[model samples]
Target chain A: MNRRSLVTIVSVSALTLTGCGQAGQGDVDNGDGPAEITMWTHSAGNPGELEVYEQIIADFNASQDDYQVVTEAFPQGAYNDAIVAAAAANDLPCLLDMDGPIVPNWAWAGYVQPLGLDPAITDSLLPTAVGIYQDEVYSAGYWDAALAIFARQSVLDDNGIRIPTVDEPWSLDEFDEALSTLQDAGYDTPLDIGAEDAGEWWSYAYSPMLQSAGGDLIDRDTMLTAEGALNGPEAVDFFTWFAGAFEQGWASDSGTIGNEEFNSDEVALSYTGVWNAMDSLDAVGDDLLILPPPDFGTGPAIGGGSWQWGISSTCSSPDGARAYLEFSFADEYITEFADNQVVIPATEGAAEASEHFSSDGDLRPFVELSQRFAVLRPETPAYPVISSTFEKAAKDIMNGADVGSTLDGAVAEIDTNIESNDGYGF
Target chain B: MTTDSLTERVVLRRRKVWSYTAMSALAVIFLFPLVFMVVSSLKPDSQILADIGSPQAFLPVGDISLDNYFGVFDRVPFGRFLFNSVLITVLTVGFGLIVNSMAGFALSRMRWRGRSLVLSLVIATLIVPFETVAVPMVYWVSKLPTLVMEGGMVKYDFGWLNSYHVQIVPFIANAFAIFLFTQYFSTIPKSLDEAARIDGANWFTIYRRIVAPLAGPAFATVAILTFLPAWNQYLWPLMVVQQESLRPVMVGMQYFFQLNTAWGEVMAYTSLITLPILIVFLSFQRAFVSSVAASGVKG
Candidate 1:
């Protein structure tokens, strides 16, 4: 080819390639009759979950003509980073789902705005399902996930252990005795506390034990510093018992993240989430008992919140986004989501209609636990740092670090991060 | 035979056996993970997890089927992801060859002023990690103008986010690729360029006819190197492309990693994604190895 012809071909190819990236199919305010608003979700691989959202969007679109919602789904693992990058580029969508715990950081970072839904809808929902930061509701979820002690009723009966209830959960001492009994009955590990999985699981699964022992992640009263609450004596006591479980050969951080060990009958109890309840029930039949988490000292506690919906700060049509958000709270959709995803529905009416999470259903115990035992993570922008610091300290403790000094170090790190960001807007 | 000869023969035989044994063991050690991934991909999630503690994990034992592979497709747009990855990798490597080789030619054969300094600066950038400048690059690219088809007329848009060009463009002119090309071209005799120049040839003609044709190993080396990183990109695409249809295979791996992870589906997805790169490497094994050894660039 001649040089000039080659240059022309190359320039044309480059221009064509550049033109291939049409703007994303979202609303551009051209003074149109009906605006098209973009929505983002983190349900890329979850067809069952994404189907529910798509139906809701379709119904919402048909119900009104003022705005038509266009939805995009990203993989759950990559969703937050995409949101952050889009926020940096000022290209955020009109609406998105925020993991309930991270709502504060996003709201504080000005990525999301207060949802401002009606009180009738908000008050009828489970408190744990509401995403509150700084005295204002920023997000709300369709359902909440609760943690439980998954045990086989036949194994408990074979080992002559009492079945614990929500009102009379096993105390720390009784739980210890049950573990010893299960161990004596030839189970190598009596419990799988999911220490094998790192990241937020460390805080979500184990931090509640500290709370049950009369300690908290941070001082909710001030939402500043982890000095007294995190490293207090009760907290240390909880960590000591936590580490002792591994040392005493009753539990170890070597098992898989799910209820695999329990389903395989390798362990007697699985400290896991409601997501695994259906699988364990299938594996063990009617013998599976989704028991409440054992109380350490003060009371039984479980981590609250799941993914919740919110409008972004840069949304062009806040009224349309809020309309979709409010419309999504319908009990029919909530029950559909809860049924499809096997989670505890947020509203009582939804729970009543949900086959799996109704008052007398197979998973009713999870609903009760979520209602009574779920404790929201510290509602401060400093929670991301606090969660990671707590995970590191908890891992170190399980791996044989000195409990007091390790927690003190975590406190130092959390306090440093909090102070660095001016207590993260306390 | 004499006693000394017999003993020496025995000693040499034993040494050969030991060498073979050690090499066989090393081969198995290196091959275990790939074998495990392929074998586990055929099994159900429960069986895969159950066999992890036993030798059965590396073997296709117990209940095995193509269910996970089917599950992978149901979960993700595997074919779309694979196509996106191959297209991006090919374009990046193809355009990269032209751009970097030309840059290499100017730095190596041409006697332009400040060539050494420019080459030095390009090599210096090899130490600056892509992660350190990724956020800044995103911010800059978001502001750069791009031609977008808007209502039947192409117009300029401010951001490059969520586009295929955003993934392909930033990665085309690589520092390591330029350095490899320059080093390889420097080894080729400059007499070829001089002879081509004497034959009524301009610099582009000399570069096209002489240096580029002679730097086959360098091009091969650059192509393989660029293809690997572009194919395996995770973080950059995650930051830029939010649309699922535009996502590559590496990001598709995250689709199978929900709360209740599908281990079998992940392995299946990985195996499917890995097949293309594996096939590419195998088809060009000789060229890839020779190019890497000649250019001193790892594949």
Candidate 2:
């Protein structure tokens, strides 16, 4: 061909290819036209979870024509680092999944948007879940799991010990007796307390112990005065008992043990979240039994409804984001999502779907615990600092340091952090 | 030999034995962590914490398994992450060497007005931390128009704010690379350039044929340093690349640990990510050593 004809043909081909590519790209961004929306999530969720989410997006696209959501997952450990960089770059995502403690920190920094719930959707949500951040709803959570103790029923039964039932939960004395019995029966690890793991074990395990002993990290009415709440005699006694268990070889020195240890019958008992039950039982094959968190006469163990979702302040489509949140709260979606994810629902109607709990006997304890004694973590800006102090003190006490003095020192550090940050009250 | 001479030889032998002992101890101290990582990668997750500080604990008390290695791929996108790291490191080193060398050659050899001023400005940028410029640079990149295509369509979406370009391009012409190249280039004999010019060669031809070839040792030095920082980069790439598909190995490793929380998988992934870089260094140690020695002699 002549040079002129060749050039013209090449140009036509290029134009057609570009047009086709544009059309394909447009299909990704809501089928209406080309648009972009960014999403950020913590890395803990399985990548497999995205398959379900993609299907949801496809269904949403089929139903309507607007903006499309492009999801991005960040490592949980480096999420803060990513957020800081994104803020500096002015390229933050439209939506983000933040940890419960980090929500206030991000909100106060004006890095997240305060989500005003649709009145229709808000009416269905549990009041406690909706008003977590402040008067204005900052985020919505779909699935939640409580931190609870998982025990080996066969081991207890073989030893002629009756385990706790829903009507008659084990008292602190009864719990200790069980641990002592398991140890005397020659089990190397009778209890798997996570004192050695970083702040996580204590945040999930010991903090509840403190609450069950009738103490809190901070008083809701007067947040600065953690002196009585966190460092009280009840807290000291609880730590002292926990340390004694470690010293007696009822628990291992390593605070971080695998869930398989409990499931594999290597350890008789372990403290962990309800989400671990399915995997744990699968490994051990049904000799497992779930129990209410051991009480200390003050109340049941204090942990519940722990995951949260928030919108990034940089979101270009807040309305579309809210619609997604509303859809997550819908009854059918919530029931399916919660059942598949193995978590408690955050909304009222979704919670009533617990009638299906009879299908899995192992899930009954979690449902019962959620109903009777689901206490939320103290949602405050000082929570991270308080959690760190508690963890440090717990570690020191576990290493055979004086429990009373350690509690006092941790309370002092927490109070100082709170006072310095002017994060005194709710 | 006299009795005193014999006694002195015995003392020297003892001293030699003591020195050998100390060196062996130092070697163990330096190599233990790596040994532990390899051994742990072969262990079950249940055995990791129990065997942490004890080598005996890692001995094959049970059948060894490749579960951890399989877990790394199953739980995280190891293959994609490996590709991303390779792409970023190769592009960064390849482009970095060329751009910095040209700028360095110009500054050192070419006599232009305000040459010192330009060199000084480049040197000054080395002191300013990249963190301070990150936000402004992202904004500037975001505002750049998408590259246009045929029929007035914007084919090349800049998505520069969260793309490979943002991670690799901002760093391609690094200040330190330029400074190193300039310092090394200045030491090259002006006679080479003069000879090339006398042979009727242009400036571009002189650079490619005469100058760059003569500065092989300097280029090797730049490549070693530049390749390392690019390979080990975590924060900047993490900031720019939002999609997991685009994440480099370091970010991928972080995600792997978060999702699995199994130390065995962590060790496996860590070993996988670091092994290639370690092999590269070991393979090129002689050249790397010579480059350093040459730079030192020149300076």
lDDT of all predictions? 0.89, 0.72
Task: Report the C-alpha displacement of residue A276, candidate 2, in angstroms.
Answer: 2.4
Give the CA lDDT, 0 to 100, for residue B108 in model 1.
81
**Taking the tens digit of each residue's C-alpha lDDT, what string does model 2 give over A1-426?**
344764575465344323322111111344457355566677432554555456565665565556666666777777777776677656677777766666666776677888766767765654334435555677666656666678766788988777887668888888888888887887788877655557555775678777888888887676565788877888877888878878888887664544766766667888776667777777666677777778886877746535466777867677777766665566766666566667766565675675434335457667667767776667676777887788888888888999888888888888888888786435
Stretches of candidate 1 exceeding 4 Å from the true structure: A1-9, A24-26, A30-33, B1-17
What tens-digit string does per-residue lDDT give for candidate 1 at A299-387?
99999988999988888888998898889999999999999999989999999999998878999999999999999898899988899
What DockQ, on C-alphas, does every prediction get?
A: 0.73, 0.24
- For candidate 2, give the DockQ: 0.24
Candidate 2 chain B least-lDDT 10 residues: B141-150
